[model samples]
Target chain A: MSVLDRLAPELITGAPLLVMQGIAKRYGPVVALEDVAATVWPGEVLGIVGESGSGKSTLLRMMNLEDTPDTGTYTLALPEVAGNLFDLDRFARRQLCARRIGIVYQNPHQGLLMGHSSSGNVAERLLVAGERRFATLRARAREALDVSEFPLNRMDDPPRLLSGGMQQRVQLAKAIALEPALLLLDEPTTGLDVSVQALVLDTLKRLQRDRAITMVIVSHDLGVIRTMADRVMVMRRGRVVEEGLVDQVFQDPQHPYTQELVHAKL
Target chain B: MPNSERGAMVPGAVVLQVEGLAKSFQMHHLGQNLHAFDHVSFTLRAGEFLLLKGPNGVGKSTLLRTIYRSYLPQAGHVWFSHGAGRTDLAHAADVDIALLRRREIGFVTQFLIARPRVAAEDIVAEPLRKAGVAAEDALEQARHWLATFGVKRDLWRAYPTSFSGGEQQKVNLARALILPPRLLLLDEPTASLDVGARAALVARLADLKAAGVAMIGVFHHPGDVAALVDRDLMLMAKEVDDVAV
Candidate 1:
């Protein structure tokens, strides 16, 4: 069965939780992104697929506010905030990201604290969200760990002690512990084995179904896009070559670039 | 490959044998004794990659250090079989251990400890120089490894102390692998490396294993190097017995 068929039904009727328009970014001498537009609805998974230097990661960084767009109107349906996200100051952006967004990097270690225990890593997000009581933090950490299928007994062990798959699970647990409104995953399974990749993807799918979390996944792996994305955005050289339903894009890619990508994988 | 197939490839003789290995530390201020591990025993074969798996503070590092003679085991024998003969690293004299290290062992740790003014290339070539290799040849090999690890040509003459953590780690790996020792001990060698560098290191390690260099490695992310592992040695807390897979 196709991946989207196994997940919870999409809630397409609701207003989009995020919207971006006219997003453009430029590095010192090169244009990293140009005129990119997208919408992420609640309870939806959007996958961005492209090769290296395609600006998919740059777009993700902008969505997470790690980098500002040179020109764009970005809006997040965050409670008590109605202004454009691009207008927020650095400190405000950091605070909003900490409390409202969860991000998992391509390298699991980048998203984790190597010196801290698994439980400590999970609890850190809660603490950042102003959770002070140890009992409360531990309880929330255990709940998140359970959702990620992390071994409860190994909670006190640091990330260095865990296997690659287990370390990715800890990263997932830490990201979801705060119950962020938006989740950003950047090539989450790029460096893992096929079996381990399947496990990580399954866990992510389960979390999406159970929590109804909105996510933006960026990957060059077509399999990951096919399995996890409800909608796929095909990008090349800083432009969106094609955007459509995952099945539609896979079965009948319109653009030549998208067709080439699909054919190469087949 | 299955463990049996690996064992069959190197028949009859073990590369490293550890028996009754034990170590403990005394906390003078707290007035407590901590035993790292007790009565641990294992056998590693030539061309084998043994992955050490365990929780933090479980003595994986301690066991490796003891085997390398960096830490003196309270009681044990680390019999490393070499071309000449077997040497007991656990009880060997300092000078003998030093000599054996030069020719038989290559250890890569997380940190690099180069002299303040030493250039990156020279730091990597120091081991070969000590082994009496010509300076020009050693530097050439060093430059080759630096390029393989993705260290830029401009950084070859720069001091490692001024390099980034990842750059320093590449230099450390290049230094350790220059001589192709009989036994290699790696402690989180890829911890500080980027994705490209990690892949390069993994490929290089695979070549070394195929060339019959026995290795024991502790990895923070074992998945990156999972293909090379032939067996697993799991160290647990003092209360539980260590498990060998």
Candidate 2:
């Protein structure tokens, strides 16, 4: 079948879900971001890549609304709330992020609550949202764990006792449990074993098939970005150097910095 | 006979006029000047198919880039027909060239550079999207073009990066022709195709020519496009021997 057939023409028709323009961020003498602009269309995966100090993580953090930009506009256009998210107060933005966005960090330890059991960890956000019934929270947690392909028998185990991959799976379970409009992943498989990384990436691939869940992924691993992202943004010195289709950027990189990055990997 | 002036006899308005075009690279460290081609001139009219023939490194592809304004012409004038008149592309401002590239010209290369996981249909539909066409309408039209080019329905969803060379070329052609620019520059588009695929491509070019989309192309096999070509320009690498390195 044609790719468009699988997408259902109507699935991709709409205004962009998020728009960021002229976004700049700085920490005293350190510039984390500068004059960057990007747009995230619903149902498309945009990959941000660069070397260590290129601000890829900063950009992803900004996308998740965890950190605000010093100057620029970030607009979140959703079914219920459509306006410049930058202008909203912290309390309102935090509320919006809780409901509309999900995030996965590079380290499983950072994303998961090791003290809680796997099931509790997954259902924590739901509990915070005021789901008080014990049976319903258990059901939702189990369902999300199943979606991430984590073993059902391990649901009661604390993430600290589970393997690295399983810990990340718990994080995945929690992130998708909310079914937010957008999912932001920062180095989703950075620290796992080579074998475990493959498993985690496959889980990401399976979850990625649901086009309705738009994603913005940040990775320093070119191979990971090449495999998962439909479009890529190459960052250098806190600025976006090149943005294009993944293959286009890899095969025919426009900027000199991007060329060096692509060549280094090759 | 190869460089014979035939555009004068073609019954259409001029689409491209290149006069005394030349390009060379300066090898500063090597203390040598590498000359690609020199004293070349040609005219292409609307709806005409112009073929460029040359040996390897003879600047045939460079000439096409010069006309497309991808490279600077060391000394020349490239007059392109736009809206109602013509602009000397050699001297046109960057903004003017950008506008013309968007609305009037397209350049297709030998290898396909596309993103992985992006369906071929979306790749073909990209030019239209850049032109502000709606996604649904542009995608519907892209499907039609892919079908016309004989890209399999199953392959439409496959990534173009995984396709065979010939299949990639077909995808490349579909993208360049989706918007049907007034002038199209193709560099070795038929380089890797088998026989039947080459014929299918020539046939498609013939249809485009009939629709008045003028074209300048460099092909590996002249026989593949002979029937569609309105004229041919033969270019040769300029011999330069003096060097200080």
Point to the candidate with the largest TM-score.
2
Which portions of model 1 miss their true places by more than 4 Å? A1-12, B1-245
Where is model 2 more than 4 Å wrong at Cα? A1-28, A34-46, A69-73, A79-90, A113-181, A189-215, A223-233, A241-256, B1-48, B58-187, B204-216, B231-245
User: Residue-wise lDDT of candidate 2 within B48-126, one digit each (tens)?
Assistant: 8888876888888878877766655577678887553577776664334545776778787877866645689988998
Tell me the tens digit of each residue's lDDT in model 1 across A206-245.
6775577999999999999988887789999999988766
Tell me how far the alpha carbon of residue A251 in candidate 1 is from the true structure, in angstroms, after superposition. Answer: 0.6
lDDT for position A170 in model 1: 89
Q: Which pairs of residues collide in candidate 2? A: A247-B115
DockQ for candidate 2, C-alpha atoms: 0.04
Score every model by TM-score. 0.50, 0.59
Rate residue A247 of model 2 by lDDT: 56
lDDT of each residue in A39-88, candidate 2, tens digit only: 77776778999888898888888877778889988887886666678778
* TM-scores for chain A over all candidates: 0.93, 0.92
Native A-B interface contacts kept, per candidate: 0.00, 0.00
